[model samples]
Target: MPRFSSDGVDIAYFDEGAGDPVLLIHGFASTKEINWVNPSWTKTLLGAGYRVIGFDHRGHGASQKLYDPELYHTRLMAEDACNLLAHLGLPRADVIGYSMGARVGAQMALLFPQAVRSLVMGGLGIHLVDGVGLPQTVADALEAPSLDDVPDAMGRTFRAFADANKADLKALAACIRGSRQVLSREEVGRIFQPVLVAIGTRDSVSGAAAPLVELLPDGTQLDIPNREHNPAVGDKVFKEGALAFLKARP
Candidate 1:
C-alpha cells in the first residue's frame, strides 16, 4: 500500500522479506497482487532469501490513474520502475516482469542499465521487436461498455479480465494507445546483463521467444510447454528458470 511519486504521479508498491532485492513488475491490466502475490512470487523469492519488491504501474491497481495517452509510454513506465528502485534505496536489483511489464523491463535495461542487476522477461517474444502484438481492437475492448459486444475472443477475454480486476478501462486503453514503440534489435543487444526470456509455447500473443533471446547479449529462453499467455504468468518453469538465472548473475 506504500506509494511514491514517479514523475508527479503517485505509484503504489510493496516491499517485503530480506536479502538481495528483486523488483516484480506486473503485466497489462494486472496489479502486483494478481501478478506477483497471487502467484506466490513474493513467498517463493522470500524463501529463497530475497527481498521482494512489487509495484502497480501508473494507472493500474492502486496507483494514480491518468487518462492521457502520453502518460503510458513504455519509456515513462520504465522510469517509474527505476524511480521505485531509487526510492527504496537499492542501487541495483534483479527485475522480473510479465507481458507489458516485460516491455517495461526491457526499456529499463535500455534506459537505466545502471539500476538493473539482472532481467527476467515473461510473456514476451518476437512480437516485442515489432511492437505490442495486440491490435487497436483489443484496446477498444478495454473501453467497450459491454463485453457482449466485443466480437473478438481475445478482446473479450482481455475485457473480461479488466472487468474482473476492476481496472480503469480508460487508462488501460490509453496505455495500449501510447505503448506502441518497439525495441530495435540493436537496442536489445545493448543489454549486457544476464537475461532470461520466459514464454509459453502455446502463447500466440507472444509469438516465439527464440528471436528475442537471440537479440540479447546474454539472453536465454524458457518455454513452458502447453501453457498460454495468462496461464504462463507464474509457471513453475518460469520461477525455476528465474531463480537459476538470478543466482548465476554476475
Candidate 2:
C-alpha cells in the first residue's frame, strides 16, 4: 500500500496506468477500493487511455484516522489532496470526485485552480452551498454510546447515501455530523475548468443536479435515469457521457 504525508496525516493512494492523469476522489466512509476499484472505474478510464490515481481520505480506508473532529474539515481534506498532487510532482491533472469527494474537489478547484485540468463531479449538488441540513441531534448521536437505539427516522433521512448497512450507516452519519461545513457557490463559480457533472436520476442525496449544473461556468450535465449514486459510477450511460465530454475538452 502506497502512502504519503499531508496536512499532518498519512494518506493512502493508488496510482495506475500511463496517460493523461485523472485523480479519483472517493466519498464519505468509502475507500478508494470501494468507490473506484470495486466499481471498475479505474479500469474503464484506464482502458480509455487515461492514467488513474485514487486516494483514501482521512478518517476512512487505509489513511491515518485522527478521532479529532477538527482534522476532518473539508478545507483540510482539500489541502491534503493539493499537497498530494504537489508531492507527486503533478502540476495539473483532471479530477473526478464523488459525494464528499466532490465537495473536496470543489474546494480544490477553487483553492488551486491552476493545479486542476478538468473536473468530473458526481453524486453531489448545489446543496454544498444551499446546505444539507445536518442538525445538532445528529451530531450528538455520533458521540453516543452504541447506536442500537438509533432512530429509524435518522436512517430514513440518510437513506440516499450509499452504504445502507448499520455500521456503515452509523459511521457515515457520524462523519457528516462531525464535519458540517458548506462550500461557497461564489467560489464554485470561480472555477473555469471544463466540468462534467453527472448525477443519478434516482440519487437520494443530490436529487436536484440541475441547480448544480447551472452553477458551473463551463459544464455538461448528464442525468442517468433509474440509477442511484453508487451504481451511476459504473452505468454505461454515465461512463460514456463523461468520457466523451472529457475527451472533447482540451
As a TM-score, model 1 comes out at 0.98
lDDT of 1 by residue, 1-250 (tens): 7999997999999999889999999998899999999998888999999999999999899999999989888999999999999998899999999999999998898899998999999998877787565689989998887999899888898899999988999998988888777888898889998889999989989878998898888999898888999999878988888899888888
Listing every candidate in turn, what is its Cα RMSD in Å to the true structure after a full C-alpha superposition? 0.9, 3.1
lDDT of 2: 0.77
Residue 101, candidate 1: alpha-carbon lDDT: 93
TM-scores, each model vs. reference: 0.98, 0.87
Q: Rate the local accuracy (lDDT) of all candidates.
A: 0.90, 0.77
Whole-model alpha-carbon lDDT for candidate 1: 0.90
User: For candidate 2, lDDT tens digit of each residue in 111-222?
Assistant: 8898789888888777667865345555445445545544655543344233342334444445666567776777777888998888899987664777877877987788
